[model samples]
Target chain A: MVAQAAWVVLLLLGIGLLLQNDLGSRLALFGIQPDLLLGALVLLARRMGPLTGLAVGFAAGLMQDGLMPDHVGLNAWLLMTAGFLCGHARESIFWESSVASALIVFLAALLHNFAQGVLASGFNLNASLQLLLRSGLPSAAYTAVFVTFVAYAVPRVLRGRD
Target chain B: MPAPRTPSDRAAFLLYIFLSFVALGVWLSPFPSPRAWVTGAASALYLPFRAVSKGVENLLGLVVEREGLLTEAAELRRARIGIQELREENQRLRDQMDFARRDSLHLVPAWVLAKRSDRLGSRVLINRGQLDGVRIGFPVIGREGLVGRVDALEGHLSRVRLLTDRASAVSASIDRSHVDGIVEGDPVEGLRMRFVSYSADVKPGDVVVTSGLGGSFPPGLPVGRVRRLGLESGGLLRRIEIEPAELPERVQDVFVLAAGDSSRGWGFLWARPVAPTDSLAESVRTPRVEP
Candidate 1:
């Protein structure tokens, strides 16, 4: 029950962070938006494994989609897939250090953006390729930086509690 | 030792797939009308949180105000001038109200609370809703000119779809030449005036106003000003670029015109059709007048 409550509190904090405009600027250069919520999902998946991560991602994505003004359900679909991939990757790969974690985050960010771009294209909402390059590349780098810290800390925190 | 795959994992994957299908369905389906109940409930829930945030913001503003008063005297002087301008505006509005009473045009004031979160779309939510006599299709205007029209109404909130939205199109005319064309938002930004004659004498900075072609909007409300004019490669028609009269990003207050028969204010134009009535009767009349 305590763990559940803690997770709920953490989720709320994550939501609050997502709502903030400056949070993106804190990590990203220029106007690119690193997916902060995705970082949190990765940590959760690492600790609690695939099923829990998938559930959390779905709920978070649904909340994001509903609150946002875009076509509903876009975020939910993307985030769920991200969670699933992250969990599957964790089970298969053995990363011993922070650098490896950053590498994984970089690759995941690339995949996430590619998926988003592909879906956007299918919907005919894709913007200029120049815009994608300018925004996408830096965002992935920043998210990788964030994951390095998070990936290092999550395991330690969970182990300490156990 | 490796753990066995669990039932929960299968369930979660199935749930993810179900949600994705649902999402795809929503995206593919015809755009839903704004959910009034959901919006109203959300607005109600947001009120307390907004109030707390506003209180904090106001407190911060007070501190800044004090600091500005002491150090930013020039800025304060400019603000005083702005306040004076506002006072003059209030007096003008009072005079306009008196004129409006005689003219039969009623103006209702509304406060704006939220803007649409979609960057690609242009929509705003006003505090007044169904309870306040606001309905879908009501025209909204800012202090400078026409803003947009109400697209959806909840119990206490209504969404205003701005003229700059790609989905919106307004019939407009150049003030000087009276050339009619349709103004619509480009998917990128700003508006494009289409269907103008190739020979139309349109120029940059020319004012565009609503032509009252359709009963959707009242006549003569300032819509925008032409910023550029260009001919398409095929050269069949002219395209005029326009900057909207209302800045969609900064508007905070607007007026909702009461919805009723538009003919009430258009009586003068209705009178014009009377002149030809007598001539037509003279041409059609025969010896039947004796009967």
Candidate 2:
């Protein structure tokens, strides 16, 4: 319970920083972003399991939806699916390197954004594929870089606990 | 130890697939507006949060202003000038209110919070919603020109479908020649004015504004200036590219024009005058101008 609480707090803080816009502006030059939230979900899925990851993803997505101006519950649904996919990948594949981790994160982010675009359009929200690509690609690239760092740091952070 | 895969796993997978399909279906389905409930809830919830955030931002600004870092008289004068500019801006908005009233148009001011991140597409979110009398199809305009239309309304939040969306079509004309054409967005960035006759005198740098042909927008709102003009392969119609007068990326505030009911049909304000010479001229010209 304590671990879960800590995780939630950390996730919320990251999201809050991202929502503030000031932090993003400051760190945008270094390509450092608040995508650590996504990285954390991926790592949690690998270490804990799929069900836990699913719950985390849903909660994180809900937080995102609340903070953002887009439709409510959209990100929650997308992130939950992304988390499930990550867990499934972990069970099926033997990805051991940072490069693989980056690739997975990139793919997951892309999928999430694509799902958002599709959903937005389905609702007659006037979203286009070109717009999705322009926004999603860079966001995926940035998330990948963040995930690499998180993947490296996760083991160090969890070494003595388990 | 081998990971266990139970019957439940199979069931869960099936459920997941079904749910995924359902989600996809919801996305594709055209009937129930996806934005109806979600937007309403989000906007309603955001009101207090936005208010709090704005308060905090203003407090921070106040602290910054009171720091007394500007010791020089010149800097103090500059600060006074800035305040005067703000006052003038406030007065201008007040004048706009008067003008709007005189014109018999109702205006609702909305604060923009976020823009669609893609450069090619145009969409924006405003902090006014159903609670603020904003409804879907409300015309959005910035200081200089027409911005877009309210595509979705939640509660206190609404999404503005920018004039640059591919699905967005505005009945606009050259201010000088009054040549009518529809301005549309390319999948790529910027707008393309379509259906202009090859004989039309449209040229680069011609100012384009809403012709008020369609009830969708008001007349005389600046759309953009012509950037390029060319002929399509058919040589039947001229293709004109326009650079939008108002940069969609930089807008912070917009006004929503209330949708008014007119006794006449759409584009009633701009209805073609009866020539009395030809009956067909009235019918052909009328339907063509309806947005």
Candidate 3:
């Protein structure tokens, strides 16, 4: 359990660093970058179930929130909810198939990006729709594509390695 | 590997939701919270990583553009020589006109880290912070003119709010007319100057500079030029539009003016009088925008 916790922390920190650096800038699509931390949360929840997923997602989101200019808890709340939902889905939906895993990642990315736009709007109902269409939509699509690619490819590579 | 929906899961979910609301409340709170410390610590940790990544990128770019860099170096060398001569001439003129030298100003130079992606406001992250004597409200200036002021500060990183941000407002005066007004930003519609009396003479092409009335910014710093002038609907003050002198997009390095330094007000611009042949001088001498 301690080893797993350590791995989660390391992965979160690594992703946070990657997101802020030039490596992240090089990967930007229409000024939107992939949310690797969010992807990690989805994968963890899908594999480890809801309880562990919630904890890891919250921790990772907190780190991400700290790095970005937005409110500190915004990412934490969104990612935690995402983790819970993904973890709960594991019981009924088998994400063992790469396509299913990719779909989960795509939906999570879209939801996460949309929530981020909502939070940035400070819950202003007037600006919410505009923010969603402007920043949220493009970011969601870009991140989903990246996350889906990772989800599909990583499993294939790992299986080949085994 | 579906974990069963046990009582523990329900309990954890309830607790997590409560915590999430608390976090949301903290975010909405009017007062500063402890989250700033977390941000500062995380930024400090990420600094080394950022530096290494930037260095690697620079190295890669150098390898890819060796020939281009060589050509750029030759151009830079000629530009440097021209700049050196211009600097000497400027110094000579300043001395000739008895303009106050900014010897007391302690400027902290910093490199831009990353520009913020927020659409609501314009901001850029810089590699200077509390450790470098950078504080909120300090004026950030580029080689050309005013860039912005530091909005948020961390241990080793700071966010500078550009003058083009909608939230930005600066007290300014026309250099030729000596008419005072407030210059404000509209992120979408560009910058606009307000509160000039209808009787005051303002025309397109008039230079605007800081008035130092608010104490937030020093006096006589070049802000922008008047793009257009129009009467306010109220028939009291004229609404003057301005174009910013410095473009934030092209800025790589900026100097943060230290706080509580009143000795660094811009006096260099006063060294030369506005030319009598200037068209705005006639407009300033005679009010053009009638009530």
Candidate 4:
């Protein structure tokens, strides 16, 4: 249990560092970057189930919140909800199929990005729609494509190693 | 399907989710110290990455453009001799005009860690902060001219509010016309020079420089150029649009100016007499927009 907790903490820290690093800024397109931390949360919760996923997602979101102190727990709330949803879907969804895993990631990214954009826009319906089309949509598509590639490739590589 | 999580796990998950929601509900931040610690740690971790990125960039430049750099160095040597003559002539002109030498101006160089041009405001976080003697309200400038002012400070990071930020205002004047005005940042227009006299001989393409009335910013730093003159408010003030000298988006490395020169008030600009005007400025109902 302690080892698992340590692994979760390290993973969160690593993802948090990537979000702020120079590479993160370079990866930004139209002022929107893929939420790599959220992608990590999806994978973790989908495999470990809701409880572990919820803890990791909340902690990861808290790390983001720490960087942007004014937006205190906004990301925490969003990511915790996102984690729960992803974890709950694991039983119903065929997890072994890479396409199903990719679909889960796509929906999670879409929901997370749109919700974040809406909240940031102060719930202005018109602005929220614009943001969803511009920032939220592109980021979700990008993250989905990235996770899909990772999902298909990583398991095969690990299986070969085993 | 796997059985649902144990009762204890379910309870813990619910509690954590509830706590996060409560945290979002509160406007007041109760975890200031922890947040500060995390930000500081994040900044500290970022330092080495910045160093590595800069080093790799320098290495690539040296490898790819070694001949270009060498040729530039040779060209600079020839330019240096011509520059010395110009410098001597400039000094002679300055002495002839009796302009005070800015020997006391001290500057601290900092790398921009991040530029936040989001909904909140246009701000840049520089690596230098209170630890590096960067005080709030210190004027930050780029190679060509004024970028912004240090708005906030931390241990080793300072947030600068760019002149393009709506909250920003600076004392500025036309270099050729000597017309005094307050330059303000607009969300749409990058910069808008406000409160200039309607009679002032200002036009497009004129260079704007700091008027030094505020004393926080050093006088004569190039602010921007008059892009277009808009007769906004159509009566008292001329809303002259300006293009910032250095685009806030492009600002990377900047110098935070520490004014060694004491407050000169209006004495410096007083050498050249401005057109005396009526006291209608008191009647204008413009909000006192402090930068």
In TM-score terms, which candidate is top? 3
Local accuracy of candidate 2 as per-residue lDDT tens digits, A1-162: 989876665445444434434444554634534455566677666665565555566656555555563555666667667766676678666667778878888887777767778776774434646755667777778878866775676776798577
For each candidate, what is the lDDT? 0.68, 0.68, 0.72, 0.73
**Candidate 3, position B265, lDDT:** 30
Worst 10 residues of 3 chain A by lDDT: A15-24
State how far residue B238 of model 3 sits from its true place (Å): 99
- RMSD to the true structure for each prediction, in A, is 35.3, 37.2, 35.6, 35.5
Q: Which tens-of-lDDT digit does each residue in A1-162 have in candidate 1?
A: 978866774445444434433365565556667777776676566666666666666656655555553645566667767776677567677756677767777776766676667676773435534445766667777887866766677778999999
What's the TM-score of chain A alone for every prediction?
0.74, 0.73, 0.80, 0.84
Query: TM-score of predicted model 2?
Result: 0.35
Which candidate order results from sorting by lDDT in descending order? 4, 3, 1, 2
lDDT of 1 by residue, B1-291 (tens): 233367766676677677667656655557574333233443454445456667877999999998887778987888999999999999999988755653444566998998863545777878876566665566799997888887666667777778888778888899988999998866465788899989998989999999978567778999989988888778989978888898788788899875333333223321122122222223235211210
DockQ computed for model 3 against the true two-chain complex using alpha carbons:
0.18
Where does candidate 1 clash, by residue pair? none
Cα deviation at B53, candidate 2, in Å, is 5.7
List, residue by residue over B1-291, the lDDT tens digit for candidate 4. 234477855665666657666646532357566556655664564456456667988999888798888888999998998899999999899875544543345688998999878554677889987667666677789998999987666657877889888888889999997898888887678999998877889989999999988655667999999999867665777889999998988999999875333233123432122111211122123323344
Off by over 4 Å in 3: A1-4, A154-162, B1-4, B51-291
True contacts kept of each: 0.34, 0.04, 0.38, 0.23
Model 1 error, position A51 (Å): 2.1
lDDT-best of 2 and 3:
3
Stretches > 4 Å off in candidate 1: A1-22, A26-28, A123-129, A150-162, B1-4, B31-291
